[model samples]
Target: MPDHQQRIAYLLARYADKTCSREELDELFSAIGQGDGPEGLEQLLEEIWQARHPAPEIDYEAVYRQIKPAVPVRKTIPLKRIAIAASLLLLAGTAYWLLPSKRTGKQATVLIQPAQRRILPATNKAVLTLSDGTTVPLDSTGKQLIQQGNVAIRQQNGQLLYASQPTDGNIHYNKLTTPRGGQFRLVLPDGTKVWLNSASMLRYPTTFSGKERVVELDGQGYFEIAANAQQPFKVKVRDMEVLVLGTDFDVMAYGDENSVNTTLLTGSILVKEGSTKQLLQPGQQAVIDNQDHQLTVKTADIRKVTAWKNGMFVFNDMALPAILREVARWYDVDIVYKASPGAELYGGGIGRDLQLADVLALLEGNGFNHFGIEGRKVIVLP
Candidate 1:
């Protein structure tokens, strides 16, 4: 092994033995961040995990809380990339190593068993509701759904495509909705692309005929509008409206959430909540409070905001309840908290492709909480 690889091995051995100092932990995280080939390191870690013997249980939550400030800064890495690195550490079983309790000054032991039931992650699936209340299920399988004059609606390569030329005066609308454990992509008549997250809906006209193209959104969706200087694009979500000529942005208007967030990625957008309006620049996010309807703009965490679109979950010091809500949505499970989870904050990255049991295992290994899977419910134990 190279000198750096040897150093990582040494650190891993010390980490597994619960002998690494706080400085060594920081060094280990920094080394992992700087590694050129994460796959090799992952393999090496797996080998070490397999070769290791049974040891006393450890409290990973306390250790993580202690070393959070030492987590290496890697702004250039994508959240999914960080997920690979973080998942490896969490899965290797070394992350749960011994740490003395702050209060008792004695090592705490926590054993988190694997979940009994298996629940898979969300997939590309949606339902298309026509203007006349007709509904059609859609998936990756390519098929033509309907034809209206010069326009045809079809599904191909997991995307709902609208193929049309300029039609007559008659206008028709369609609504695409995804269920709890589902997501989908769409191509509008004007070549605009849309990605709908889990439990989201998008409603739009089949063909653009007016000076302004308008669409209604009920949940989360990422849009890349087709450029048409003559016809500006507009998205209406409840009382708020987003107006743009040609831009890339994401809107999260889930009813359960306390606020509607609009994050701008490219170009400018005018957000209108009734008479009040705020023009947002790229890399900025507009937050509208649901109670007071107050609108505010601030710098956005681009990677964390967009991680869902790239099949990853990035938690940046998110509350435990909020994290469980996300887990429930993606896994299509009910979260039953038997005890108050308190105000604990969690930070990490994990792939969205993992099964429910695997995700729970990663979270439970933190040693702050225990979880049990019963049917379609995820129980948070005391």
Candidate 2:
């Protein structure tokens, strides 16, 4: 091992023994940033494990046998504080080999990291606008239910549910809006589930008495529509309309993007923009140009598109500005770009639960190191 690796081993010993100083913790974390591949990390893990379990002089094969039999319980390991940083480096494409050698085909994971400055993850928060123009602040954990006529709307643990009561012929509309640093889930009166992303809005009726169940959407939302063939669900986004019956789909119609994307997950959906209409199958996406209103359908990666609803930020050939836009929305931060990474396509997946500084550090590890944060503003250096 090199001198730095030796030092890392020594620090790992101190860390495992819970005797490492604050300075030593920072040093170990910095050394972890310099780690090249899984070989070095594996050696460090072995050293740390041995330090924690000194009496058991077990070899690699013995350790593997001990873990391979039944379902091994997950225990907190040493360097828990810095593991998130290490994992971020690996996720940012710094060293793909930094992943464990044993898990070659497994998906990437996110770990919690300590940062000098932190911007916490977005939470389940939103505002409700009723048809009577009354505003209600929604809390994910609140049991407050708003009764309007035959509709009962209540929020429970990040999900807004609407239960039906005895209804008349009147139809009342309700709107749910998520702020920049928030997200929300809603169950419409028709039993359709919708996951609204940050900076999005959904306007739907409290009771669907009409022949067509229509809802208006702005920004991004994932929908799992109820199988009601009698009343097809239609989501209107800008000038486009997505018509579906008993299907799962995602609609992204943010104002910053030049196009509106409707990705079909399970059942089929018809995306209509202006006079042009396109039918999308499962794993297909319909891209409608915001300016020209031209609609084009293509195959898409459903996981990548729906990753936000799954608490992940999945970038597949995404541009830097676009990625930063997402970060800005989720973190509720302002961004200033000093130099543009024109047409640079980045591919990676990181948990959306991470703080802003950790995400930026991951980008720095991936060689985009010229960035500074002042207050809630991020300055991208040249």
Candidate number achieving the greatest TM-score relative to the actual structure: 1
Using Cα atoms with residue i matched to residue i, what is each candidate's TM-score against the true structure? 0.77, 0.72
* C-alpha lDDT score of every prediction, in listed order: 0.75, 0.71
Summed over model 2, clashes come to 0
User: Per-residue CA lDDT of candidate 2, range 53-121, in tens?
Assistant: 443443433332322211112223233323433332232212221111111222212222234277787
lDDT computed for candidate 1? 0.75
List where candidate 1 sits over 4 angstroms from the true fold: 1-116
Give a tens-digit lDDT track for model 1, residues 123-205.
88899998889888987774766776667887877889898677777788899999999999999999999999998999999
- Clashes per candidate, residues 3 or more apart or on different chains: 0, 0
| Per-residue lDDT value at 192 in model 2 | 93
